[model samples]
Target: MIRTPKKLWVMHRIGNKLQKINNIIKVIPEWRQRYIVNNVEGVNSKDLAQKWASYTRDSSLFIKEDDIVGIEDESRLLEESLMDGELQQTLISVVGMGGSGKTTLVAKMYNNETVKSHFDCYAWITISQTYIRDELFRSLIKEFHQSRKEQQPPELSGKDYVELVNILRSYLDLKEYLVVLDDVWDTNLWEVIKVALPDNHLGSRIMLTTRKEDVGSFSSGVISYIFHIKPLKGSEAWHLFCKKAFSSYPDKSCPRELELLASELVGKCKGLPLAVVALGGLMSSKKSITEWRSVYDNLNWQLNNNQMLEVVKSILLLSFNDLPYPLKHCFLYCCLFPEDYIIRRKRLIRLWMAEGFIQRVNRITPAEVAESYLMELIFGACFKLY
Candidate 1:
C-alpha cells in the first residue's frame, strides 16, 4: 500500500497537527475542565410556545416538483422577479445562513419545467466558499453542453481565460440561458466570470445563493434582485420538527406530558429547518420519554452559551453536538483541514483509524465502524463531503 505524493503530504500535515494537539493537552488540565461558559445574559427568550399538538415536517425534502413548507411566499416572489421584464437579462441573488433552505429553494426552481422552458439552456454550479476560476468555467461550460446535448459542442478542453470567455459568450450570444452560481463567496470570482456572459439582452438569468450579504451586494450591483431568506416561523418550524420526529408515527402527537418540553425545543431551533430536522432525526430513534427529556434539558448546552452568535454556526454546532460521543471525535477530526477544503470519505476514514478515533467491533474492521460514523455526521448535516 504505497501512498501517493498528495496523500503523503496530507499525512505529514496530520502528524504536525497531532504534535500541536499533544502540546495543547499538556497545557490544559483536562478535557472536562476546558469548557464553554455562557455568561452573557439579556436575551429575554420568548416562551414562544404554541398550543399546537401535532408537528408537520415536509414529506418531500427533495427539490422535486412538490413545493415545500415555510417559504411559499418567497417562491412566489422569486417567480415574479424571474418573470418581471421581457427580453432583459436579470441578476437574481438569494442570501441566507447555512441550513436556511437557500440551496433547497434553488434546487426546486433549477429543475422546474417552467424555468426550464423559459430558458434555452440551464447550468447549475455549486460554488463553494473556496473556488477555482478555471474549474468554475469548465463546469459552467460542461453544464451548458449537457443541457442542449448539441451535435458538436465547442471543444472546452485546454482553453485559456480569454479563449474560454470568448467561447462562452459566443454560445450565449443569441441564446437565453438560466445560470445559477450557487453558494458564491467572493465577488472577484463573479467579476472574472461575468466577462464570459454576453448581455445579449435576451432575458438571460443569473441566480446565486450565498451566506454572505456582501456577496449578494457585490454580485448584484444595480438592476439586480436580492432575496434574503429568514428562518422559519414558529409554527412552520414546529411543523418541520414534527415531520421529522413523527414521520413514522403520523398519528402520534407530543403527549400532554411532553408538550411544554416540545414547544421549548422547537423554540430553541429558532425556525431553522435543518436544525429542526436534525433534532427530529435524533429524537425519532429514541423510544422513551426520558430520552426526549434529556435532549430538551441539554438543548442549551448543545447549542452553546450565546444565542446571539451567527445563526449558521449555531445550527451547525447544534448538529455536531448531537452526534454520538464516539462519532464526536471522528467528526472533529475533519477540522484539521482548513475551512471549505474538500474532504473525501475514504481519506477521512483512514485518518480516523490512524488517530484511533474509530471504534473496533467484533469481526468488523475499524474502517467499517469509522465509515458508519462518517455517514451519521453527513446525514446529520454536521459534516459535508466533497
Candidate 2:
C-alpha cells in the first residue's frame, strides 16, 4: 500500500538517516508496487479521470472575496493595458506565486463595471494543467453566448471541433473582447487557444495569469507587458487576516484580547494571502479567545517540532509520487548538482541518458525521450521551467 500521509511524514523524519543504505532502494519500489496492487489495481479510467478532474477543480478554488484588501494599483494597470492600447491586440500577463491572490485580482478586473462597459464581450477560462482543448472551446463558446444575450448563437453542441473554433472566431469578429486565460502551464495549450482568438485590431486584449515566471515570460509576446505580483505586505496581510478571522463579527476586527495572538499567527503565514485568509476562516469558527490561542499554539508547536517541514515534505512527496517511474529517477538525480545552480537543459538530458533514466521508445532517440520526460515534470508543476 502507498504510505499514508502520516506514515510519509514519519519517513520525512528519517529520510537523511537512512541515506547510507543503497539496498533500501529495491525494497521501497517493491513495497510501492505491492501497495498499488492491493489498494489501487482495479480503478477504472472514468473514475480516475473524475478523481483527477475533481482534485484539479478543488485545488483551483476561485474565491471572490467580499473585501479586496490592497490591489488598486493592479486594478488600474489591468484597465490601462486593455484600454490604452492602439488597437494593437495587446497581451497582459499577471504572474504570481500560487495562493497569492492572482485569481482574485484578475476576477476583480473581469467584473469591473468600467472595464465591462469598454469591451464588447468578456471571457474567463481557468486552464488546469491537464485541460482538454475540446472542452476548452465548448467553455469559450458557451461564455460567448452568455456574454451576448441578444442572440442565441448557432448550435455549437452538434458541431465538430474545427466548426466550433470557426464559430467562436466569427463571434469574436471586429468587436473588442477582453479574454482572461488563467492558470496556463503548457505552451502547447497556448498554441491551440490562440487559433480561436482573432486579434481583429479592434482594441481586443488578452489577460493571462500563471504561477511561473518563465511561463509568464514566454507568453509575454511583447517585452514590457508582464506584471509580476508581489506577495501581500505586512499591513495588508493583517488587514486580510482580520477580515476573515472575524467574518461573523459586524466590525470584522479581532477583539483586543486576541489581537496579539492573531498577529503572531498572521506573521507565521509569511504574508501569503491564501494562508492568511484560510487562517481567518479557521479562526472565524473558533468560539472563544482560548480556541484562537489553542490554534496558534498547536501551529507554533508544530513549527518548533519541525512538523511544518514534514507537512512541506508531504506536499513535495505527493508531487514526487505522481511522476512516472523512469522520470522519478532522473528528477531525483538532479540533487547531485549544487543548490541554486543553473544547469543547462541539453547537459541535463545527457546526464539523464548516462544514468539510464531515459528509456528507449519506438523510433525515439534517448535525448528526445529524456527531454520530453523532463518537460512533462516541468509543466506538471513539479519544477519551474526556466
Candidate 3:
C-alpha cells in the first residue's frame, strides 16, 4: 500500500518510534530493493522519509526542453507584450480552456532564455481552484528563497505574515522581474493582492493564466489583449500525432490507406493538441489498418469513456452545453456540419438568422448578435472551426 506522508508520520508518533527501526530491518534482506529503503537516522519519525520523497517529487517538476513543445509564438507574444508596455503593475494574462496549453505557454515563458536573461528576479506560483491570498504569498516567498538558494527563516503568522509579504514585495520592487500567477480562478484574490505589489515599472510583468474569461477580463481590464489560446491547426495536430504515435512524424512506410484514415481522424481533433495525441497514442499499438478503422469508427464513443480515453471531447461537450440558451442552440446547430468544415462567418450568421436565434440588441444587427454568440461559444470551448 502506498502510504501518505501524514499517515506514516502519525503512525510513527502515536504508535512506536521503534517501528521505523523494524522497517529498516525488514528492508535489509531485500537489498535488491535497497533504493526503496528509507534510512531514518536523526529524524525519529517515518515522516522524515516521506518528507524526503515528497521533496524529491517537487524538485523533479521543473520543465525540460524535451518535455515542452509548440509554444514559441506564445512565448514571443508574452515577452514582447510585456516589454512594449510602460504602465506600472502591467497585467498580462493567458486565457484558454483546460488542456489547451495555457499553463504550458506560461511555463515556456517562465523558463525561456530571454526571459531569464532580461528579468532580475522571477516568481512562479500555481493558484489552484481554492486559492487563498496568504497561501499564495507564502508560496511566492518560498519560490523566491528557493531560487536564490537562501534559507527561509522561521514561519510567520497573523500580522507578521502580512509584514513578511510586504518585505518580499519590496525586494521584488527593487528589481525588474516577471511574476507568473498560474492557474488562477479567483477575481477576489487579484483585488486583495494587486494593492500590495510595488509599481516597479521597468518592464516588469505579471502573467496570469485561467480557463475562465471573466477572471482574465477583471484582472487585466483589457479583454481584447487576453490571449485566448486554441489547439494546434490540422497540419500541426497531424505532425504532433505522427511524432507521438509513430515515434517520428510519419515514420517510413505508412500505407496510403492508413495515411488517409489517420488524416480523417486528425480532422476530427478540431486542432486540439491533447485530443490528437491521445487518439494517436490509443492506436499506436495496432499495426493493422483494420484495427485503426475500428478505433476511428468509435471515436465518439471513446470520448465518453474517460477510463479508456484521454480525449477531452466529452469535457468540451460539457462546456458547450453550459452556454446561454441561444448560444447553446446555435453551437449545437454547427455540429451538423462535417468535421474540419471551414465555416464562413457571413454564412453562419445568415443561417442563425433563418433559425431566428438572433435578435437585435441595442443598435447591433441580428448578424452581429449571431456573430457575438458564436464568439462566446468558441471561447467557451463549444465551437471550433477553421
Candidate 4:
C-alpha cells in the first residue's frame, strides 16, 4: 500500500524522537557510572582529592574580579547581613537554583578580609547531599584550625563522632565564628551539625548556600534570612559573556560583524551565569564568524553533548535528579513541548493526567497532583511560569 506524504513525515518525526530518547538513555548510565567511579569507597589518592577539591572550591579563588559581573549589589547586601546582624548566632542562607551564582557570591563574602576580621574564627565546609557525618565533622575541624594558621589536631582522624563534636563545641564556644556550609542538600544534616556549633551570642553566623529554599528556615531556630539569587540581567549577561568570549581582545568587546551572532548565543543562555560563562569559554578559541555561526546553529546539541559544557549539564541534572519519580516523568513530559511554548496551566494538567504521569492520592485528585508537580518544577527552577 502506498503511504501518504503526511503519514511518511509523521513516521520520520517519530523515528527521530526515538533516536533522541535512546541517546538520553545511554547518557544516564554513563553519568551514573562516572559518579560511582569517582566517589567509590577507598578511592583516597591525593591527586584525586585535589582534583575534586578544585571542582568544589569557591570560584572566587580562581575567577578574576573583572570577570565577576552583575553581583555587586548582592555582594554588598550579603556582606551587610553577615557583618551587622543580631548578636545571637543566626542562620543566613543564600538560596538559588544551581548555577545561579549562589556559591560564588557567598564565597566572595566568606573570603573578604573585612568580613573575616569581624569574626573571631571562620570555617568553610562544602556539604554534599550524601555527606558522611564523621567526614563532615573532620572537615569542619580542619577548616576551623587551618583558618587560624594553627595545626589541626593530630588525633582528628582517630576521634569518634561524639569526640569530634565536643572538640568543635569547645573550640567555638567563646569565639564569634563565621561558618559557611556550602552546597547544602539535606536539612537533617544541618539539624544534626548545628548542635556542634555553640550560640555564644557574640554575633556568630552560620551562612549557607543551598538550592533548596526551605532548608534555611527549617534549619534556623533564631533569626534567618533567605537571600534568593537571581540570574544576570540582559546587560550583565552580555558583559559577562564578552568577558569570557573575548578575553584576549582589547576591552573584551565583540567585533561589529559578530555582534548579532554573539547576542543570539548569549540570549540562548537565558541570563544563567554558568551557561553564559561556559558558552563564552567554549567560543573564546574560535576566531571566525563561520565557527561562531556553527556553534549558534547547534547550541542545544552542544549543551547536552559537549564535554566542555559538562559543568552546566551536571548542575541542571542535579536539580532534575532530585525530583521524585513521578515528578520526573511529569517534568520530561513538559519538555516535549517546543522551546518558549507558553503552556496553559489547565491544559498542561489535563495533558499530564492523560499521559498517566499524574497519580491520584487518597484525598487529592490527579489534577491537584499535577499542579503540585508543576509547582515543584517551578520552585526547583526547572520551569519558569510566565
lDDT of every model, 2 decimals: 0.68, 0.67, 0.62, 0.73
Q: Is candidate 2 or candidate 3 better by TM-score?
A: 2
Residue 367 Cα positional deviation in candidate 4, in Å, after optimal superposition: 62
Q: Which ten residues in a row have the lowest lDDT in candidate 2?
A: 52-61
Per-residue accuracy of model 1 over 1-386 as CA lDDT, tens digit each: 98999999999999999999999879655532333212222212131111000001111134223225688888888887776666677788889876678877776777678878888988887676567687678778888988898643456667878777777888889998889887788877667788888778878888988878888888533358889999888887777777666657746466566677778877877677666766766776666779777766666664566655444344455555666788877755554453334456776676677667877799988878887887676556564332
TM-score of 2: 0.61
**Each prediction's TM-score against the native?**
0.66, 0.61, 0.59, 0.65
lDDT score, candidate 2: 0.67
Per-residue error (Å), model 4, residue 349: 54
The clash number for model 2 is: 1
lDDT of 2 by residue, 1-386 (tens): 78899989888878766774666775767755543322222334445433332222222133444556666798788778778856867777788876566776777788778888899988777675667688678778777667877464667567788987888888888779988888877756656787888878788888888877766667434323788778779999898878766877778877888888888888877765656665665566677878777777667666677663432222233345546799777766654442223357877786677568888899998889988997665533344332
- Model 3: which ten-residue window has the lowest total lDDT? 52-61
> After superposition on all CA atoms, how large is the RMSD of candidate 3?
21.2
Cα displacement (Å) at residue 311, model 3:
3.8
Question: In model 2, which regions exceed 4 Å deviation?
Answer: 1-66, 150-155, 220-224, 247-253, 297-386
Candidate 2, residue 66: the lDDT equals: 58
Task: Write down the TM-score for model 3.
Answer: 0.59
